[model samples]
Target chain A: MLFVFTYAQQKGTAKNPFILNPTDSTVVWGSYWSEMPPVLHIHSGDYVRVRTVLTSNPEHLIKAGVPANQIEKQLIAVQAVKDRGPGGHVLTGPVFIEEAAPGDVLEVHIDSIDLPIDYGYNGIGQGGFLSDEIFDRKTKIIHLDREKMLGHFADGIEIPLHPFFGSMGVAPPKKAGRWNSAPPWIHGGNLDNKELVTGTSLYLPVFVKGALFEIGDGHAAQGDGEVDITAIETSLIGKLHFIVHKGKSLQWPRAESATHIITMGFDRDLNAATHIAVRQMIDYLMQTKKLSEADAYMLCSVAADVVITELVDGNVGVHVMLPKYIFVSH
Target chain B: MLFVFTYAQQKGTAKNPFILNPTDSTVVWGSYWSEMPPVLHIHSGDYVRVRTVLTSNPEHLIKAGVPANQIEKQLIAVQAVKDRGPGGHVLTGPVFIEEAAPGDVLEVHIDSIDLPIDYGYNGIGQGGFLSDEIFDRKTKIIHLDREKMLGHFADGIEIPLHPFFGSMGVAPPKKAGRWNSAPPWIHGGNLDNKELVTGTSLYLPVFVKGALFEIGDGHAAQGDGEVDITAIETSLIGKLHFIVHKGKSLQWPRAESATHIITMGFDRDLNAATHIAVRQMIDYLMQTKKLSEADAYMLCSVAADVVITELVDGNVGVHVMLPKYIFVSH
Candidate 1:
């Protein structure tokens, strides 16, 4: 199934780009709707700087007795309209990229992610991933010390901050219908991987033409599993550059940082997802490094690390990391 | 079903201890037989210096054309007897520790692991964890550089060597029969976790009186999954001190390094194992830190990292690592 995009006039520049604000009417709430209109249009190799608010409601925070001063002004200003769909994350965008077509790959290079505020929240509810194991619901507001690059979790506990977008994806195949922004799939929505921080490139398979790329769910810091269903949830402004690789098709999303190449897989079964990720890494090694299949598989066993991105997402996420230093040259 | 151990005269001092050689008659191939006799006996708090060999036949390596000069003399002298059953791991002991009983916990402090030889092998067989994905059986010999702490896998690929015992466990519950040494259970055998290196303490639930602890299957280096079913398998001498916790109980094996506390879980289902590990971490936080369940769970989400130890083992292994720096004055 193909998706036809009615492109809008391009406005963002390579250096000083047009900002897609979360407060704008173009913001999507909860679900990734393939039919959604493109909020902005950009060509491949162009830059688009965007802003995203945490997936929370000012009314809910106020009702829960958070002081008015503690609430982010942006949170208060953004209208919480109920017209969105089947999920709960407040995502920003659906930026249509010119020349990105089906059977191609979209490469997103994350330049920087900046936190506008010095606070964030982590919430655990009865509907969390480990709800069967833990049956309580609570919220914790954490103070971020930007200078120290730490999140003050408690009086003496601190967490190192590695800010990144938890969700970054293109619209799925037109046949998949409107998808929830919770579970990641072939199109790579809500990956919730902490390793995709600054200086990393995320590659997603483009199933639809123009590649309606959306980004949201910012986290200041998060451990691997995201077991409690939330991270240091906060709003963020990110500088991103996009490039489309025509004729390069992928079955699942993959990423690369300075030190490592990453392969990802998502499925309801954790084992199945893990296998997919491992196979993808094996494929990458064989294709890129010119290693035999046996050598690639063995190399993975002795060198690659597989990690769970998030268990709470309906389709559990797994990623295999192969350190680049092992290769003679890249 | 209880197997009584006839104790031998203890000979080792806390500082200078007796060594249990893997080639001695005491070594057992494969299954952890409760009925097997202890090679040595020691009191709680006493130190035991032990030696282990890789789980490959010297004849096989020689037939594969490894030069006779390259093979360690000990490997050639150690006769590969045919009295092994159920599994194929060449485990070195069932060291009897006095005063360790069922319901107690055995705390094994790993003082050091040193390579006696400068080589190791990684093998993948048709019966491996990913056998369906990969059919060929192969072996790759690696050169270990002790001074550099690296395993030279190939011309340019160097794996950082983190030597640790792959299997460390006491005798299983007597009624469980002779258990194969492949899967890790409540008694903790073949965990294959790279984090259980020197200076770490592995805590295993005692299932038999005297805690017939055995250790073997050394690795110079290994990644998380052990996907090809082998690490940098090698022989090493390890110095370990044992202490029996009188009343402390644990449902699964737990460990602590200088920087983190680790909780483990094992199950046929990866997701189920992950849940068990996460729940164990939450329990650990609640009990030790005096935090509410909700807060503990949230803390885990923000600070703890859950990793896959190995997937090839019959019961897949998962471990949750909670960094100790997050706790104040622990």
Candidate 2:
């Protein structure tokens, strides 16, 4: 209820949105527990301007050469949350959506992502794709150029900036108990898929009452595989609009960008992950395009692109992006 | 000697170029052998318009419901090739480039690719990503709309047309002796990579004197993974200009699209293959971008994209594409 005053001050009504900032009581670290209580209650179609912080501690950021003045006070403040757990990511909520029960779908419309931070860091340690062969355990501090929308990577090199949340999900099935935030599954945590940028709508299936949802692990920019096990890890603020679809169901999380329909899968083996993505795509085509199973499978081979999302997570990921333009005039 | 009259009439000299069509005597199916003699000899800076035929048997194409007239007559005539592969692909070369010796780099300038065929096929077979689970080994014949540059994949589905030669490479090292054309290696054979479309230049490391170059396995369009183990496998013709860089040396094949510099790797293990691609990209950045090993490694994580080229090739493939736009004013 601490957010009530802030919500009212921001003129948050049933029709209007409010702001949710990370604080000691509002943020959870490392793992997701189904038993965790919600800190806020909101109705469907509500827009929340939420602010999330990177998992790195303020001490670490400053040690990595980030200026103290640039560090968000909220990040330093959240360090008092002693409940931090078995994992490392710091997530920002379990917002309980009223009437969102099991079997429902949570449609997250990512309206905007604002980047106010000027720096981030990429650390290379253990568990990366090539970590065994090339063990260079080091971290590089990358400065972001807001005007050019790029990262000053080296003396003569620059990287394009595409900001997005690397992790977002609801509570897992009750029987699963506490879940680590390291791997993404049916709950969709730590997807680390770069395609989930702004203007994308991620449809995640609801598994519990109220459909408690949380988001964090921001990336300033990342390549497809995240081969080194890190991106331009940074903090990001998002304005998200949530809609609860009561009748629809989805086996795997799906996403839609401005120009394409996206599907995802995660598995220990990259080959199996690829298979799951392709099959999900075929299922999507069969239902939406009204094509026979045979036709959908063939179309996937000739049309849709299945790309590696991340290879470092315990469960590597692969996603399918089928351009919406290809389904025109139907 | 047999092609002397044809070469002279077409003015196929050091500066000028001529066409080489696939015939029973000119084409080699499947395996690539270093002992294979060159069918044509040309100098550096020379252009060759190479025509290739699909490896499908004409009778099988007709049985799969493809119109008989749509089958290339050259495909029918190539049945007499007793040297037809220990593999399944039909390649149309062994074009020796004079002075192209080991430690040199052969720059293949792909000026254009013409898709004159009206049809192609996608076959799902064993060894595919999902073959063991989804055992529907059927072939689909797709019709091309030349005017629209699209493939009619289904009753209401249309796929954007992108034509390119799937198999194109030089001879492997002499020590390797006979090599199957199913996988790509230092020789770059059967690199089912779709990024090598029109206007893309492929750079292959020359392995022996008079680099024995071969090209075939055309595709009308394909997704990244080629999950079902095939694309719109079609016959295509490519106009390529070869330039021998006598001083340049490379360890693996590389390519460049209009907007990005590309690196590639192939291995049976996807993880190992990805490692190879990333290392090659790091090597590229260190050499061309003048970056230190640490800077190049960090730049790859922050900038370059590592994508799965194909999962079904005997040696699966991965490629890295670093966009050219990010390097401006540097």
Candidate 3:
């Protein structure tokens, strides 16, 4: 069974007391949100659904098929949109998991992504990486059809759309502070893994009680670094399932697919991030292949690899991979 | 015919400068470096053989099949092995191509890589991203086998081996200046593309006469960023064949192979780096698909993607590609 949470209409604090911080743990639970706090009970195989919001001003809306020119006008009219309310990613969960705990890795399996027509950000603006010289206009409004599987830039160019969430994190440790959605930490936030699409299993470190997890910031598509500072920001209704492993201390996050073993690295500098990724992979290698640390490091330098995760985000993330064919035990 | 260059000796001078500098145009004529430079006078479709060096302190050495204690003793005996010396990354160039000229991108198709036995290093120390906490001892020592492939850690961990040049650049423009061989620039220095193995076609931007290109600093393998600030630095003997195109203006370097459309991005910031990469790919996409600029840009954001090129080597580079299956000419 899958649980779906849509922020259709929000009530008062009496209904929802869980302030949506990426690192916040569940305290007073109410029925304001769709999924309740700290208990996503499921068997070895069960499907779950998650809904997310956009990172733009809620009061603003771009009707279907709005041209780039008029979109500029609307953006200029609402330059100070942030003054109206709290400015940050607001997650909608703490989906209680009956069988999650510290030292164990929570496996989140994503199934599908559904986006409504009235959802998703629609614009091409300046100040992005390419905006340095390419963007001439203030805004290029985009109003894509809900069924549009691809977006067009010019007459002959077509792009395939792959939508996924930009933010997904479990509650931090018992003592972990309130976390923002800007960076990726042990609990996992803003992990923009492209493969996190349909049919991928993500393993995250569980720190807090019951793993009060939340996910949001859905993106239609985003590059490795989200270099433009924004991907096709969109609201998404996603179906996901969960399986909890008890008493497994994951120093960091691990992801597995049919083809690869990916360890996500989060840090401020690229070198440091890459080191963490490489070391973690080495640990995996040691456990599976029975090699020494020196050999693992050498393997990383020669065979395994490091890839940049996201550079445009506040904190940098890197990914290190150990191809699946090498590990025979699995 | 193919050309190979091996530095029998080192002679640094203004006209024949040894190091590569970005601002300097004189040292721009080179591409990809193994142990030394390839010999001058390479022709299209010709195979070229080259040599490489390892990052070891010349002052240290160890016998074949030495015991672990002996290896440890050698490592503790020496320090300061990171520096390679003034006569570093020598190149072979100015082959005087009949059809090559300014503005065209020279394509270097890598053939194969082979290593010599009795390989060793000076202090495989702690300096990479994980140095702060896990500070391993540094030392210089030699190994018994030149064909050393893997380094063991504990159990279940084994790494693969892939080697390539760390430095590759074209001859400096006729304008004149000395150069440094640390960063990759318009001339493509220290590109370190792992895909640059045998059967890969690398396109280098030509800025001067004869494209007097050169290559050096070969490593068995390296992660995306070379994040530890160093790879498995080693001396090597490699082979390469060159083909030059005349009168074609390529803003940057590009590569193509049977399964990949490799566009390289080098910049100070990740955002700019991604923009450059996506822009080049957009250009490629437009040229191949007959799409306008707008369409190409949109396609890039949606279909084409960013891959971490090298984050550790002074500058950050990204590779963006659109799988061939995603687009086919109508």
TM-score of B-chain for each predicted structure, in order: 0.93, 0.95, 0.70
Off by more than 4 A, model 1: A1-15, A80-82, B1-15, B76-82
User: How accurate locally is residue B7 in candidate 2, as Cα lDDT from 0 to 100?
Assistant: 25
Q: Write the per-residue lDDT of candidate 3 for residues A172-272, one digit (tens) a residue.
A: 66554555566777778677666577667788887765676677777776656554555667667677776788866788878887778888878877556
Report how far residue B99 has shifted in candidate 3, in Å.
4.4
Question: Best-fitting candidate, measured by DockQ?
Answer: 2
Tens-digit lDDT track for model 1 on B1-330? Answer: 999999554656557776777664768778786787887888898888898888777777766556777777656555655677677877878898888999999999999999998888888976566798687788888888999988887777888889999999988999988999988888899899989999999999998888899898999988898889889999988999999999998888999999999999999889888988998888888888878888888988888888889998889999999889766542
Error of 2 at B223 (Å): 0.5
Q: If both were scored by TM-score, which would come out higher, candidate 1 or candidate 2?
A: 2
On lDDT, who's better, 2 or 3?
Answer: 2
lDDT of each: 0.86, 0.85, 0.57
Best prediction by lDDT: 1
| Consecutive 10-residue window with the lowest summed lDDT within model 1 chain A | A7-16
Every model's Cα RMSD, please? 5.6, 3.0, 10.1
Name the lDDT value of residue B144 in candidate 2: 83
Runs off by more than 4 Å, candidate 2: A1-15, B1-16
DockQ of each: 0.52, 0.61, 0.21
Task: Report residue B275 deviation for candidate 1 (angstroms).
Answer: 1.8
